[model samples]
Target chain A: MNEDKKIGILDEKTYSNQIHLIGRVGSALLLMFMLGIPFVIGTVYDCMPKFSWLIQPSIALLAMMGPTSVSEVLGYAPVLGSGNYIAFITGNIMNLKLPAAISAHALAGVQPNTPEGDAVGTMAIAISSIITVIICAIGVLVFIPMQPILTSAAFKTASNYLVHALMGSMILNTFGKGKGKTVIKNKLMLPLVAIAMSVAGVLLIPKFSSYQGYAMLVAIVITIGWAYLLYKKGVVKVVNRDEK
Target chain B: MSYLDIANSGLTYTLVAVALSVMLGLCVVFYVKTRKRALELGISKEVLNKVNRSTILFTIVPSLTIVVGLFAMSAMIGTAWSWFRLSVVGSVSYELMAAQTTVASLDIADTATADGSVFVAVMFVMSIGALVGPTLSAILTKPVTQNLQKAGAQNNGFSPIMNACFMLAIMSVIIPIRVSTGGLVGLMVILTAVLLSMLIDKIASKGVAWLGQFNMPICLLVGMLSSLVWAKLLG
Candidate 1:
């Protein structure tokens, strides 16, 4: 909201376009590399599987993954900004990259959609991606000595609970106010979340657990629509802290 | 060759190394791009550095799940492939699902019987299936991010509220599935995290400057660790 602190208009699009190019090129390269691994095994190692074996499963998996890919990219892209490229490539969007980007912006006292927030998000995601690669490398290097601990019951339990833990902490940020300075007043906010969760608990999870990204995508659309309704109702007041 | 032989071979490790190197290179590229823009946007070096430090700390605990994924997939596939997949375009859920498809179809009881056919099936399926999200993301992210921000700026005062409501709504959907599937331990983890998060916010609000950086990490660790206690007592 600080005009003096924001990117000036002479080449205002400089940051967005530069990041777009980076994201585009980076994405294309990653795709090649990702697909290349399978090609390498097929050609060099001479270990191609029967095409027939893949026929049934490939269709099934694609049917599932296709929608998932669309939903995740569509849902996460707007929020992720320039960081989307690295985030999607590096994966762990829900569990790591998304939260990392959001928190980075919040902790730095930046807004969601500005150049500052986008840049900080990209940087935060990059830092996060690097750490995961290093950790996995370490995990690979020390697998023998670390086998028991990695496979332990306690470790499994904690890993299963990690996402919930992250979600719980992050949800607090939305309820009132933190970095964004603006908030959806709790009058409408409380009923909105409670009803949405009740619907999800009743309708989505039990039926579509395997298809969570898609289900989440649906929830997002409905939430946005409902928010729009609230917007029209004139009940969703968001007075900026500076203006106040 | 035996499945384990190919799965854990020297070449396999080398492939993973090369892939990992490429990912790291991309990360560096992204880091530099954003850092430059952040500076131009009048963000201070001190704040940027704080962002970096905070992000690194925030990432570590959540990355426990990634570590867990690596171990889980390594058992089904191999360490090198597991490492590679988890590093690039692979999630714990997606990788496991893909691997399980190969396992069930091939009836792969153990590493010994998982032949070249099984390995090939696994890799191809995992690689190809995992490509969807990132591939589309590559094509669509810029337009999406740019347009969304543009819309927000053009709109009058509603965008932030919409964003806040959306954030909360997304959490509403996620929390139930996660907690429901998680059973009692999930609820306990969330309760612990919420309390800790509130405490951090309260203290930070009271002018504890540096404490902000550790908020998410502290909450994540205690929340996750609390699961062990909940499971022990309740299970």
Candidate 2:
């Protein structure tokens, strides 16, 4: 391990380069697989969809999901760091990947957007993805037998609240104490204002519900502006330590 | 084979299995490679192991929830497509909405009566609609990370503040949705989770270090399980 560390120190840049290269290649291949699956199924089943059939729903979904997709990438990439590649491929960004990354960083005693944080985030995402795949695979295998139990009203109700529970825990853990509290203290007004604005937007103007998709984006923009004001006012202290 | 036969055929099952295998294989490969790089960065083995273990623990509930989602989708599409699509990209809700849109567009009474061509179209649209995130991430992550790093370099607090704002923004949107939709039971779960998390953090701060590792998962389980009680009382 000592010898490995010596080599690691000597070749840190090379290692980073390798990771970047591999990630790009892996992502490209995964993209092909994603696209390829439908095509392969179409061919083997001898059921080609007409262009119009493809275009109509595609346009509808793209219209609905396009902006949010853009926002998620822009918003989450920074927090995810190197884990962006894996997280994006595996899906479940907001609920699974982001929470896992944040939780892992907290557990590892690292702050986000740092080398240690990035490393920990990447490892956490990888493990989380693996576990998700395993569990989903098992679920698929037993889905026939388990359908009644899994789809039960009691289980369904609990499952519906799962995200609430997960996000509640995540918010508390991520912003509960220490550095998180410090950051929150300095910028508490931002979230409060954003939350108020979101509630007002979603509730007061029912017609504006069409634009409800942009709620997160709007809140983020508002919070970023408020944070900037705090930064300029020197209310929030930016701490930059040397990379360990 | 007819449309229904094709949909439920051995061939379709084989293809789904192969696709799943490839997906899982890619994840494993990525995990091994990334873990190696992390190790190369000199992260301690102990830290990596702990993170890995805790992450798996944290993921169980959410992953099972996704399974429930998969079951819901299986009602629309068949089991193979539901499993494959949810495993690959898009949440259950997103895929279900896309599938519904296609079904409506085709004017099919139900997914069961839909022909193979209709199923293919549904799958195609679902896959394409969900591609934007991963595709954009693959294209934009490097530049985004670079810009964030540059900003952080100029302002020591930029990255941390930005991260906090991002997280808060997400929570701000989600919490309201949960509150309004989840009702009394949901509210109870959220409050339970928040309070439990605070207690755990307090305990961890008092020197029970191991508890810190399990804090989020513990709170999550308590919150989810207690929802049953809340449900019963509210009902």
Candidate 3:
């Protein structure tokens, strides 16, 4: 029964959607515009300054491109496409005085899987870009020059924890969902697996002691095993049973 | 032009940008609402199969409206308008900034104030956004429920590969599109969030049940507001 179920789940019928035709073309066009305008403007602004008036229009055009009909765009797609631009710009606007990676970390939280926890988490990345930039700018430009001692005291590694804060939020979100069982199981056993494989490799290859292939081999095995188990147990079973 | 005229043009450009986004967004909301209604009302299987198509329409409609609106505004405003012409002015300003810095550098031999320093700064910031957004999207997209609580464990048959691949494709398309010529910054940020969500299938995930797929207007509104501020202050 399990075998049969797995086969059914792997089939293509499960991928069928309910979206309409007009919706498809419309969504594509909107996505193009939303994605296209800012890139053009930013690239132009960054590359050529002769056409400065295009900056605001470029921003306005990009802002208006958010997902409307499909809930898909804002949930995950933006993190990759539009969110990157936001982060990049946020970092740019701050003049890179702020750690640029923080923006990506923040937007990662807006992913749709987490329980609606706090508005801060929702807006943390977006807010952080502005806040960090302002804080850093003041510290670097005004405070440092005016009160070197005080500004130096304020400068600490703690300020850079924006990325960590965002990551913690993501970890918390994943844990809250209770769906990371597979990940947890793998993480727990992987240490033992790693040790065993390392010892075996040393014993089998006398001259290969310097080789790291053993570790790579172990990782491959574990990944393949996990994927197979997930496919057979989760994916296949779900698809086949639903068809019934 | 008089100060009042300049003020009016700026304000008008800002409003028009917002209006376009809101109108486009509203159309999408309505389209989704109607589609949901159809689903609830028991649309035929054949019709249901086309629901995705309808959803696509909501996005396309708003997109077209935005493009047309931009062209119309640009033509009406004239070549010297600053609102929608970020590329043209920023380049010139930065070049001026570079030239000024170069002269200063030549006078003092200070590399920190040179053009090279500015390039590094901008690139560094852009990289940060690229890394964080995708990671966040991936983390947020983890499923809430794994095995069903019923008799036997039944999977949703969700394809992580498909999800990841689809997201990558969506992101790939969106990144270039927003950053391309004539693109706006506000729309880009909002769309980034949207694209992140879509890539991770966050909309379909239970935790963030309210996530939407395509929303150009909200992004545009927020982005425009910020851009306007950026322009007024930084311009």
Candidate 4:
């Protein structure tokens, strides 16, 4: 409600200035501790050899990812808290069963290049890579027991819908700010680039599923490029264009 | 067999999820006020009004939608949670768990329902957990160090400890989250919380940087705790 609190110009240069060093370090340490638990360790061991390193950070990432996904799906606000609960729970929990991606995504806030960003960035990278490994493991684990369930229930179709529903909501929300043409342009470009990159990876690499990072990076880069182009060309003038 | 029975079960968990959400929502509202010191500044009224409007639209409407959606989804899925009668569709892990449970004859095909009264109790308790977690965090971390000068806390080190404890409690619930919703959904749900946090702060740029930063983790922990408790007690 504090009208003065509303920032007029949010430039990309100084997007999130409130990145706390103590907070990021605290979160990272907590994440490392949480990932070192017995149940988590045991689950990683049982799951596969590749995912062993993931058990700890994945817990933290999952903690972060839940809030992000929910907000995206609902077209609401995303949480930007330090990973307190995530760190705590990861350290203490017995049967940590959260997906690996959540943890990776959660740690995304930890931007390590900046003075305080280093911890967060490391945390993010660590957790995300760990999660990717876990997902690969889960794919392998589920292959045998899951085929019957998948074929019978048409799970691929259902999963596609679920993923689409979630991603569609995210796309709408993310590009909700721009003008009609710009929004549409970015929207069109993002999917096309993502799919094209995905297809390229699928053709080039035997295993398409393992290239999640590549696909995600390509999509992100394309979206960023589109946004930059739109901004540069004055296609999307956000909040008080007449001033500058 | 009856519409009433189906409605009753759907109503129970739907309300449970809503009530849990509301309690946590109120806690977030409360934290926003306290951390921002909105009441003292006399700006809370405007924020409250905006929140109230959004609450009605976001909380109430979605709660209702989920209630109806849950019921319809459950029936369509043909396999509902016996205890709560809530829909378990798209949850492959739960289906697998149900398939694997030999002790309870965890029959995925069994449409046989359990006594609905039990879920009523389960829902009530879960709601309480959701309510308690945030309030407890607020109290424990309620900024004992006070300075009339600065807009922020004086860094007395207590806040950090409280934060640690808060995170620890949330971490504890991961096991239960894994058990009930499977690891994947639990992960997604947590990310969803973060996503919501970012959007909330962007919309409500009310100077409460701490709230913007920490709200998602708090909500994630509280929400999961309640959900975990619900799954544990009911299942």
Best by lDDT: 1
Best by DockQ: 1
Q: What share of the true interface contacts does each candidate keep?
A: 0.70, 0.63, 0.01, 0.00
Residues B66-183, model 2: lDDT tens digits: 8998878777777777777777666887888888898888888866766788877877888888878778877887777656655653535566676667667767776776677677
lDDT of 2 by residue, A115-189 (tens): 566677877887888888888889988887878888788787777778778877887756554333233344555
Relative to the unseen true structure, what is the C-alpha lDDT of residue A162 in candidate 2, on a scale of 0 to 100?
A: 85
Judge candidate 2 at residue A182 and give its lDDT.
39
In order of TM-score, best first, we have 1, 2, 4, 3
Every model: Cα RMSD to truth: 3.0, 4.2, 18.0, 18.5
lDDT of 3 by residue, A1-244 (tens): 9998677444311211111222233334333333343344335434322233333333332232212211232232222222222222222221111111122222222222111111111122233333332333233234224343322322212122212222222222222222221222222222233344544554565543223323333333443344446556543222221233
Off by over 4 Å in 4: A1-161, A178-195, A198-209, A225-244, B1-235
Per-candidate local distance difference test: 0.76, 0.75, 0.29, 0.28
Summed backbone clashes in each candidate are 0, 1, 108, 54
Candidate 3 CAPRI-style tier:
incorrect
Q: State residue B209's C-alpha deviation in candidate 1, in Å.
A: 1.9
Runs in model 2 deviating more than 4 A are: A1-17, A178-190, A205-213, A238-244, B40-42, B154-159
Q: How would you encode candidate 1's per-residue C-alpha lDDT over A153-215 as one tens digit per residue?
A: 888888778888887777666454666555445434533644455455556445545666666
- Report the interface RMSD that candidate 2 achieves against the true structure, in angstroms: 2.4
TM-score of 3: 0.27
Superposition error at B152 for model 2 (Å): 1.7
The interface root mean square deviation of candidate 4 comes to 18.3
Label model 1 with its docking quality class.
medium
Off by over 4 Å in 1: A1-10, A180-205, A240-244, B106-111
Model 4, span A1-244: residue lDDT tens:
4453344223211222222233333333322322222123223223212232333333333343334332221110011122222212121111111111122222222111121222232232223222322332343334456446544433332332232122222221232322111112222322333445554655565644433423443444454454445546755332321333
